[model samples]
Target: MSTSRRTPVTTGLVTALVGFTSSFAVVLAGLRAVGASDTEAASGLLVLCVTQAVGMIVLSWRYRLPITLAWSTPGAAMLAGAAATDGGWPAAVGAFVVTGLLVLATAGWPALGRLVARIPQPVAHAMLAGVLLPLCVAPVRALVTSPWLVAPVVLTWLVLLRRAPRWAVPAAFAMTMVVVGIWLARHGDALDGPLLPHLALTAPTLEWQAVVGIALPLYVVTMAAQNVPGVAVMASYGFTVPWRAAMATTGIGTVVGAPGGGHAINLAAITAAMTAGPEAGPERERRWIAAQTAGWAYLVIALGSTALATVVVAAPAGVVEAVAGLALIGTLGAALHGAVTAEGPREPAVVTFVVAASGVAVAGIGAAFWALVAGVVVHAVVVRRASGADAADEDAATSPSPTPGR
Candidate 1:
């Protein structure tokens, strides 16, 4: 009896660990990239994990949807590449709250969904690509500096990418663990203190920079990259997602957790494939059970975040960054393709991409917001200029060309 229960429980728990471990470095790198201290970043991770777990459990049980929730990985990537805006982490928290409110507003008014949907895809894709471009260089740089250490992890990711593409990042993380373990054992260093929950909060303050730079962009990426695709993933699995309530659950969860350093939470984009699949269970109706188990499992991760935080700090910087960079390799490629492939907005998208990658800040706002603004203006200007040129050429071809013959 015990073995039977333990078997399913273990599967669910392993899924959660995989989920958490696969993305935690991205989250940590993002918080630090956005001006969070180490303690603050760890606190954010713990709060985000716990809050997402709560949202997942409640929404899954209440609606009986296999709702798997996650932090905005793209949003975190944006933060990782972003320059700090006014009020730093506190303002970022403030933006987080605004983002939560915006998400809730979408739930309240379905029209907002349509409005959000109108954001030009090329621009969105460009913004993400720009944001991710800087941080994705870490693995390459690490290879230059610590080839022996970083190569094994990168090689592991490459090998797994061929056979088990889904497991590639986690596999890289595993290889990193083995290398770091050996390094630690040889050095005689140990993680200090018992693993447990700890709280760190940044007092929220509304600032224009945070609202425009952090909140708006954060909301955009979460919706575009995570929630929208996540809903599609659920639909593909033949599940009916109560989209409004699902948005509300994630939004409200973010609101509650943001003051304590958590970033936004939303429906899982990637992990939904795991929890909503045949591997989760044989019966479709029973897959919510897997989601339930995942929730409890995430809570376990929350509890151990302090120790995890210690491990991250104690390890070499390249170690964490190499894995994070490897994890984002696929995302960065997709973003680049999506941003530039479209004919209409290609010029503007490149403008956006360059501004964002350059990491310039203006008027207390980060490069991301400015990048969007710059792209839009440039796109409009170029389009209008091209239209004028086309009109002039048509006039010349139609009427004035006879002078050349004379």
Candidate 2:
């Protein structure tokens, strides 16, 4: 192949590796939060990670856009909430299908897509910040229970993040493994387990209650709270791709992976932005190939679920938390700046961010959806009134015939 083609392909592989490594901790946490049995959760995550990688590759290749696919982090939170109400794996999958359909529908309708696009940047940023705040807090909360285990790891992560942002995660993981190994050795914990691989397949079962109660809500949260912003992030990076096609790719991936208990697959915004940015490559156009490489690498990970989960489980919790938090610092700061910097929209954006971070759930919907609703109402009332007043003044000035007659 020519030098130009080879460069994208190489950069694409590197992007995938970096993206997957950075985000894997979050994925593992999502699985555990939802109470998946060790084996089942491992299998499900394997499916999710692989399918996402594949979808990213296919879509990037097709559009020649630097679009990277990832499992929905916010969607995982919705599933965690649903699981709290006794929704099982089947229910989560059901929710995935519902959300996939919603995304598909949104993409199919040009008017709706336009409406989604028209949401103010401040509002979108607020929503993104709101959705991510909980994730940042999860590790801190974990620290309360396991300070001995979590503290050293977290501190190491912070220092590494400050000194070497790119290597922070991997460094934290290494430190965590060392800590765990030492602790295990001191306590004489058994390290013996089947070091062999096992394969288990789960067939999809339809559950009506799960569909309505769990699946629908999850679908809505994933698409609205997660995927929409994902598209916006891509656009911000100067890559404009079709949302409909991307959603369709996720839907099809969900369908394909459903039998193995995968929930949903979608575009990754924050993490993708990290890899597709100047950090990953010298040339802009080569970024798409990075996403493509990530997709294939994800498939390799899926095939090795047992080994991967074991590694994740073995890592100290603090290490994962601190690294995830640190990696997200830049993203969080950007979201906050966007949310609060706008002159007229700051109040509404603040409201959205607070409501989203409150972790409040009413009628089974998450804070992300509610935040958008609240912000829009405020924007409409405030912005429309100002617009109306301006229109009235213009009308008064232009009323020539009445004055002339008088």
Candidate 3:
């Protein structure tokens, strides 16, 4: 193939490679945190991959835009922090289903999408920052607890972070594989049973807490952090994504994958830049080929989900988590910056951050949902006071009070 054609294919493959390798650990960890068994987590991984791949292919082909899709990394992080619900794994699955439905609703109802857009940016960022805090700190705690195992991973990450930068997380993951292999070699019979992909579906059962705690938060984070940014990224590259169609595709994918352990899928944000930008070749019209290539690449990656899950299952407790933590540090920094930088909502954002980071779950609802509540409440009060003050000042400025002095 000519370089023009070959460039997008290679870029697309890289998009898939980087997207999958960098965050799949977090996805597994997130699924496990929400009460999925090892087999279930592996199943989630498989379905997440397959569904996203299919979504990307369909969207890119149908629209002829580089409309890539991804599993919700932020949503996964939120899940990692969330405790199991009263209904257990089934409830989590139910939350996933609800989240998918909400996404579908957003596509069907413009008002719903508008409501999501109305969420204060600082508050949204704060909630994500808080959800990510516990996971991002894992490397530090892991280093203290298991220095020998985690040190190499951290060092590799640091080195690559300064050098290649984009490959840092994936490289750290590679180091983790090395460390896991060595540890496994040292202790024979660590891994048992087949390491092959398979599905493990569970019938979903909804609980109010899980719906409020998990589904609501998942939908918000996926929308705010992934889908919205994804649309912007494509636009920046001179392509307007079909927002409703994209949401419909991802919502259906999420629902189909839910019973089998997947959390949620949405448009690709960071990876979208790679596939849609000049890196995919200077020809804007042809960049959709990159997304198509990425779809196929994700399918290829899916074949190894079970094997990777087995490794995660067998690795030393802190090792895989350490890699996951390393992958998220950049995201955590971005979230923090976004959370505190808004002038109008800074205090409310801080309040949200404190509450979220506190990890306080009230009445069985997770901290993320409560964080938004606190932020919005504080925001409303603050905005109201500010508006009242503005009104008073305006009245004073225009009033006849100075007539007495005159």
Task: Choose 1 or 2, whichever is better by lDDT.
Answer: 1
Worst lDDT window (10 residues) for model 1?
1-10
**lDDT to native, each model:** 0.85, 0.66, 0.93
Candidate 3: tens digits of C-alpha lDDT, residues 1-406: 7899899999999999999989999999999988999999999999999999999999899989999999999999999988678889999999999999999998989999899878899999999999899998999999999999999999999999999998999999999999999999988846863488899999999999999999999999999999999999989878998989999999999999999999999999999999999999978899999999999999999999889998889999899999998889888898899888778748888898888888888888889999999999999999999999999999989987655555
Candidates 1 and 3 compared: the better one by TM-score is: 3
Candidate 2: residue 18 Cα off by (Å): 2.0
Better TM-score candidate (2, 3): 3
Q: Kindly provide the TM-score of model 2 when superposed on the true structure, using C-alpha atoms.
A: 0.76
**Candidate whose TM-score is highest:** 3
Lowest lDDT block of 10, candidate 3: 187-196
Q: Write the per-residue lDDT of candidate 2 for residues 1-406, one digit (tens) a residue.
A: 8665666666656555666566556665655554455566666677787778778878888887778877766555444433333455555555556656656676677675566657776877776677667677756876787888777767777787789776676666666667777876787776442233444465544565556545554565465555777788887888786777887888788767655556677777766676567654667877777677767777776666566566556554555565565445566677788788888747778787887677666564545566777887888887988899999999999987565555
TM-score per candidate, in order? 0.90, 0.76, 0.97
> What RMSD value applies to candidate 1?
3.3
Per-residue C-alpha lDDT of model 1 across residues 1-406, encoded as one tens digit per residue: 5544444345567678778878889998888877788888889999999999998889888987678898888999988877687688888889889999999999999888898787777888888899898778989999999888899999999999999887888899889888888888888998654356778888888989889989888898898888998999999999978989989998898898888888899999778877787777666777787788889889878988877776887777698899998888888898899898887747889888999999888877788888878877887798899999999999888884455545
| Model 2 ranges off by over 4 Å | 1-10, 63-66, 77-83, 118-121, 141-148, 190-243, 270-289, 311-323, 363-366, 381-406
What does the lDDT read for residue 366 in candidate 1?
80
The lDDT, on a scale of 0 to 1, for candidate 2 is: 0.66
